[model samples]
Target chain A: MPMRTVRFLFFLLSIAAGIGLGLVYGWLIKTPDPGQLTPQVLRADFKADYVLMVAQVYQRDQNLAQAVQRLSRLDPASPARTVAQALLTARDLQYDPADLQVMSDLSRALQSLETPAATGEPAP
Target chain B: MNDNESRGNLYLFTGLILGLAVGLLISLVISPVEFVDIDPSAMGEAYRNEYRLLIAQAFQSDGNLQRARERLALLREADPARSLAMQAQQLVGEGASPADARALALLAAALTNPQGIAFTPQPSPTLPPGEEAQTTREVGQAIFTPTPPLPTRTPVPTFTPRPTATPMRALDAPFVLESRQDVCDGSLPAGRLVIEVFDRDGNPMAGVPVQVVWGQNQTSLFYTGLAPEISPGYADFQMEAGVVYTLRVGAVSDTLNDLSVPACGGGVRVVFREGR
Candidate 1:
């Protein structure tokens, strides 16, 4: 065989070998386990549900002080709370937290409001 | 083997090594792992499904298709509503469970018209002839205040269980005492306790009257969800460490021992659900 022929054959063999090994790696070497049935996921699910509960509370009373207090119990800016608030503002779809404009407005508002309190305590 | 043959074998080996490395990289990049942090996939299907459902609910409630799409894009579903109708129809196919069909129908409707879902306010359930007069009012208007205007009993029904197959009281309503911390946030310096209540169906119950009794007959009455609109279903209260609080709502109540918190100071949240 010519030199070029030998090189071509070698390349083909290499490609075949590589494909075989890659298959092994993709299937047998890799394992997937749900591992999702854990306390952490459970807690996250409950928190998500709780956010809905909070929204219902807002609908009932429109009491902002209690709203802030409860939201603070969870993370002040958590996605759960965000979902709740978004749901609470259902009167106008444009104002929903899911809306890009509303989300941007909210972010800007939060950033502007984010000055350290004069109380010398950490900012909430 | 001859010299030429040996060199050829070496070239084949080199090619093999190169191909293997490239192939390995390709395999891993295409591999779909369930958990991004654990399995190397950015996001798993589980989280995506949850995101989809949440966005669908939001769209159904708000009728904001644009907002729903924006939220969906965050999860890499740039064109979320494109197939929402198909997917919803599939879920709403014949023989689907009633709840699933209703949810999917809502999703489909929202996909068509975001602002179309109209929620009729549930009519206040009527009470017995004599008792009806006292209890007939807005669901949350009868909140009990903890501090000012204390201890004035009114004709408004406070926590009386209604007799009906379906309860007037929302199922999810209850006081959720969240926090494992011994100290309250600096925002409310004297505030150490937060009480959150949810109505039945797990919605936050607002303006429900409650009594927080700590110390000797030291009673303070208030309703949950008196917080700012940003923070709903929460009431703020201050409690001294080592003191115990007995929270009475309607007929049932629970006690919270501040001493239960470690001196190291993480907060404890004592959740009180209605009728619990």
Candidate 2:
């Protein structure tokens, strides 16, 4: 029994194996891509970006029902409020008011939306 | 256990610990999480442009340097002047159409030194060709003269009194904040803050008196809709951005200092499962 003695060597070899395993795991889990910004990473610009997305969606889709659904995810006070803020932000940013006419249309469309009370407010 | 068996167990434990430590070290160097170095020059390109434009517009409206500097600082630009110059050049280099020529010109105006003259974007097309050329010439003068020359004046001009202008007063604002969905001093304009009160049965309560107050005893009182639709347990009050208000409803009271962003997108919400 005194034989299997080199306990340190056994421990060292196992440690080495663990290190190799860790490297393998690291390679498998890819990191973020360069120049690639996800919605979560771009949290600071999300508010402004949200408005732009809404504008694009509103323009291409041109449907009030779907626009409201998409906008509701933004957690705005209301869809109309988001539109109003977008208009003001656009104005403040000096974007052409004419280009934001759709925002005004979206604003009107949101008025007919069944109020938050009907659907229940989204979770904070 | 035998000595050999006991020794093997110890070795295994040691190996596991060492392996984990080595692997962590290797991973740290060989495969770290990706992180791109962010700089103001590269990050939020659209947002930066828009913000710079806002600064220019605000400067136009107020002609206030201290305020302008404070706002531009938000862009994280150490040298806003340099940043503005590059943006102007970028705009012009983009081969902007004649319609966009003014915006390019505005960038130049923002970059101009000795900003004493007022700048109004979208120059009048009615300006005669020669006059417009002359105006451009003045801005061109600024592009080269990094260190602007001091204004030359023979003497203090005689003061001519101009008529004083009246200031626009904000309407008295009042709203209840005890319930959910109440906000104060929000940075954006939402519409009027509408709070709908409900009863124990989850039905909208009408004719509930709500009081809103701000600044030294000024108060406005209104009852939630007398009828379901009118008050429908719902009441709205006009609120100005950047002001704080206190609300009192049936002994439920709280403070709201959120700036309005548009109706209540998501500033305040008081949960009322057991609606009082």
Candidate 3:
């Protein structure tokens, strides 16, 4: 190949190598703190525990609005769905039966909230 | 040709450096590493508070100290009890539900001196028919015991009662005023309502909630043992000189009225001993 063509190819190769190094540094060497991260990235077990907590509090307070408010932090679009997901994870993890029962209570509560009849409003 | 080769090498080096900068910006700012399936240890400060609150509430619901301890370990705090206690104090100041603050404080107290406290049975959700309540698990209780202020301090209270499975409020231990001393010293701050709490045995208790009410039902709630340097079970409030205040320790304690700061530019000290 001509010297100019060869030089251009070398430049491209160098650029690719630089990009790879930069990616490694950013993604691995200097990652953000786990404690400083959002809940969306939480492990399945932690998410399940969080849901159980909401359930436990809901059971005590019996306030659907407050329960929904707390769950909305985990999944804004559908807090009920988040509870359901947590129930599944809790079951898979073989959590204590009492804990599972509380989660189920919350899931049922959230499901009731999503229903139109429970809210005294017509379905959309 | 030699000069041309040197120029070509310089161009390649420039391209590499330029590409590296672009990649770093894209990775660090534009498209940073996205976290997935992370544990509680990696949660942000606010979420960590939420997590701590959840642990305390769960403990309240199930009365599971060991489980709560295990969950709290995920946070990797150097002193989990201290963190819970501080959070409890903050929640009380923020006007959170008394139950929430009490739960955190209960857990902190449980962790601090497990042997000295007893927990009352908290009501649980009704179980399904035929699914007997799990009675095998060892339940946790909620009363906090005071630690002595110093090695040479007064004799610690004797821990006697360990009530079983009785349903009671978190802070049901009734305390009565043991003594009230008015100090009119030039050294102390003006209008300070200094209070100390002890068990029936004269042991100084930590994490006792103190309530002060004044001026048409205006109230301020605070906890003791926050400032360990002075003494555990020691908490003070700044009182307006003219306003008369009522002081109560815990839920069932007898309210003490006419507790105003003495006019001598000093503080008043009140000692409470558990009546039961």
Using lDDT as the measure, the top candidate is 3
The ten-residue window of minimal lDDT in model 2 chain B covers B135-144
* Candidate 2: residue B238 Cα off by (Å): 57
- Runs in model 1 with CA error above 4 Å? A1-4, A12-124, B2-10, B26-276
Tell me the native contact fraction for each prediction: 0.23, 0.37, 0.69
Q: How do the residues B1-276 of candidate 3 rate in per-residue lDDT, one tens digit apiece? A: 999879878988887897788779867877777666556766789988988988887666666565677778777799898898788778877898766776777677667655333453333445567864322122121111122122121111111111122332344778889999887865557888889887666666655789999998899987765544455567789888888999998778889999887867688889998777
By TM-score, how accurate is candidate 1? 0.28
Model 2: per-residue lDDT, tens digit, B1-276?
A: 699778768778777777867776666564454332122233346546744644443343333343344445545666675565455435434643321222222333333432311222232225344542111011011011112233331111111111121121111223233345545466323546566655555544433445668778877665443222232455566666556666665334444444343344434433221222
Name the top TM-score candidate.
3
Q: Which sections of candidate 3 miss by over 4 Å? A: A21-25, A28-35, A118-124, B1-14, B17-31, B118-167, B170-175, B182-192, B196-209, B214-218, B224-234, B238-244, B250-254, B260-267, B273-276
lDDT-superior candidate, 2 or 3: 3
Q: Choose the strongest candidate by DockQ.
A: 3
Model 2 off-target regions past 4 Å?
A: A1-124, B1-68, B97-101, B104-108, B111-276
The digit string of per-residue lDDT tens for model 1 on B41-128 reads 1234544444455455433344334444444444444344434433433443343333333333344343433332222122234555
